[model samples]
Target: VTFLCLPPVSFLLLPHALALWACTRSCPSRCTCTQEKSCSVLCDRINMADLPKEFPCEASSINLDKNNLKFLSERAFGTLPSLKSLSLDHNNISFITPGAFKGLPNLVELKMAHNEYIRYLHTRTFTSLKRLVRLDLSDCNLFSMPDRIFIEQTALKELLCFQNNFRRVPGAIRGMENLTHVYLERNRIEAVAYNSLLGLTSLKYLNLQENRINVIHDEAFKDLQQLENFYLNDNLLAELPKQAFKGLSRLKMLNLGGNLLTNVSKTWFSDLVELEVLYLDRNQLCFIEEGAFENLTSLITLHLNSNNLTALPFSVFQPIYFIGRLYLFRNPWECDCSLEWLKEWMENYKLVRDIPCASPSSVAGLDLSEVVYARLNGTCVDPAELNLTTALPDNPTTENKFNILISKLLQQELKEDLVNSTESFRNGTLLDPAESQVSGGYNGFSTGRALLVLLSMYLIQAETGPH
Candidate 1:
């Protein structure tokens, strides 16, 4: 209380200004430093040759994207003890030492995507980040991943690695117990191992669309019991194995458009009772089996455009009465009389949206709603319509005359056979043309017409007897 010596007001402010200057000096070069009472380092277009040794990011996040950062020290994030999020994306980072992220245990999100040169990643790089939730390495020019890249981060939920050149999904993701979503679309994946996703029980959505998956081994998705949306569009899938979607009891939407499927079997998708939307456009399918969608009673929307189909299987859509929309355009639909049933069913159900034609060969000027399938029921006209009758060289008569003469001979033979055989034409038990007044009954074609033809043929044969 007795010592009250004051140097000056400016002398007290000088030390505060010096402390702020020290925070700025510790930040890396080519980065903007913001200071209020705390310091934050924001780097834009910065050359990340090395991490600043004295950088003090104990109270703020850091942005270090779009740089020519080639390498990082083993403990590059050692000084950022309180950094919440770190962005080192779109850089030329090719190599990282064994322990790149040695510190910064509080990091929540890390974005290192779209870096063409950052092809390699070490497994233990994120070992110290216990609280890391979202890890995005998308579009990073990565061809493969270490098996145990995320084995230590059991708390990770979302992993986004889409738009990359991965030959297969990382094999080490089997230990992610709490993982929810995995996005790996637009890659070059050919095969997916069954045990590759062994431990992801809580996974909900998996997007493997726009890939080069030529084959889907049986039980490829055996462990993904909770998966909902599975997209496999724009691939080279020619056929689906029976067990392809075996364990996906909750799948909702499936897009199989733009593939090379020729035939679809009922058993291939019989277990997906909860499927709603199915896209089958732009394929080579010609015939859809009758019971293909029998078990999928919950289906609402079905797309079948741009295919090689001539006819829909009989009773294919009869069981799926709950469907709302069906797309059948741009297909070679055979619009014959057999389509009468389809037209009637369509009219009954009022399914008019899926009635467009892709070409003139099927429905050129006729309206699908106005036209009835009964008009196209008959086959081509009979060959008798053409005058191409030939005379048997041995018999020397036209087929029509020969047929009549053969009929008379058959009648005479029948009469002789009845007389010689135990069965007699005299009894009422026999079929007799004389006793029956009903023409065309069990005896002949037309009532009087067939009798006259047979009688005239017999008269001619009687006039020219043995010859």
Candidate 2:
């Protein structure tokens, strides 16, 4: 026999060429096949009305998304023991027989999202996919699932079920201990009852935003000890139980924006010591009790903008040591003596946004930084002239007395600095209006005086009550 001469690259590609030729011969009509580490078939958007009757046995992945397939018969994909991934998203599939996915033992991912006609599924639909790690069934108009639907998928890790008609969290997810992420946003969920999420110990992220959730049981999330990120924004929550978030110690970020909360209670977050970012914006909050965030020592960013707050007591945020970003804009701030501590605090915490005055028309619309002591109707007492020792009661506590003296000393120095700055501004020695608005304006200020007046009004309130 004549010896065939071939290059080294051709020799290496010979096996792949033979595999591709075999896959092409077995590939069904209107489909393409290629040889990678394994065979992959692309039959997406083919306008097919049924699953292809023939597929290469060696095919490890298939994409049939955006097709007209409306029904899935039993054993739809016949005994593809090597199939690892399948995408049937954006199809018109409305019915799935019990054993439709019976032969996909090694399949790790199954995406059938956007099949809006599918509202119910048989309990044994996915019973054979024991090794499936990710499942996407979102936008299927599903209202509920059988209690034992996911009882066998112990290896499932992520579940995406957003934009559905579910009235509550599916009870089928109660025992998914290996699940790490769940997306249930934009659903019709009305409440989160206790034990609704009973045994998901490995969960790290949960999204329930844009739901109708108005109530959360006290221990609803007590089992999620490892959860780190939670989103509950744009809900109808008017209030939460005091112990609603009791056991979530590792949570780092919480979003409660766009809710109906009228006040914030201190007990709601007493155990969240590792929390770093908090979003409480766009609510109906008019009051926040003292020490509301005392346990959040690691808090870094806080959002209190777009609320109904007229004034906030300074003690609510005194415990957060690492706070860096504070958003306090778009609220009805009453610029009075009780708000003097806020002005003093914002002067040092330069990362704070501009807080405009809403009452006492003289300072209305003016930033808190621009409102001088003289404009507060002379309500704030000059610390240099006030006697701290005489202001105290007959038998004052040591902590109270120490805090009063420190507040007096701080106010005295701040008053003197303000007087000198005002005099310089009048004498044309300070920066111009444009320069001041850019350099030492509301967005930019010096540090080191943030804690100066932290406990001033709080301690005073304890002795003399609100100013």
Best by lDDT: 2
**Candidate 1 regions with alpha-carbon error over 4 angstroms:** 1-41, 45-56, 338-354, 358-362, 365-367, 370-467
Worst 10 residues of 1 by lDDT: 380-389
Q: Write candidate 1's Cα lDDT for 1-467 as tens digits.
A: 11133234475586556546655656676677776665667885766666566566544667788877878778876757777778888887888787777777777888888877777787776777788888888888888888877767778888888888888877867768788889899889886776767878888888888888888877878878888787888888898887788878788888889889997787777778899999899889998888888888899988888889877755876688888888887776655444556767778877644554322343543444544321101332111211222222333334444454455445554555455563334454544454433533453322334655666676668557867
* Per-residue lDDT of 355 in model 1: 55
Clashes of 2: 0
The residue pairs that clash in candidate 2, if any, are none
Task: Pull out the clashing pairs in model 1.
Answer: 337-376, 337-377, 439-447
TM-score of each: 0.69, 0.78
> Residue 31 CA error for candidate 1 (Å)?
4.2
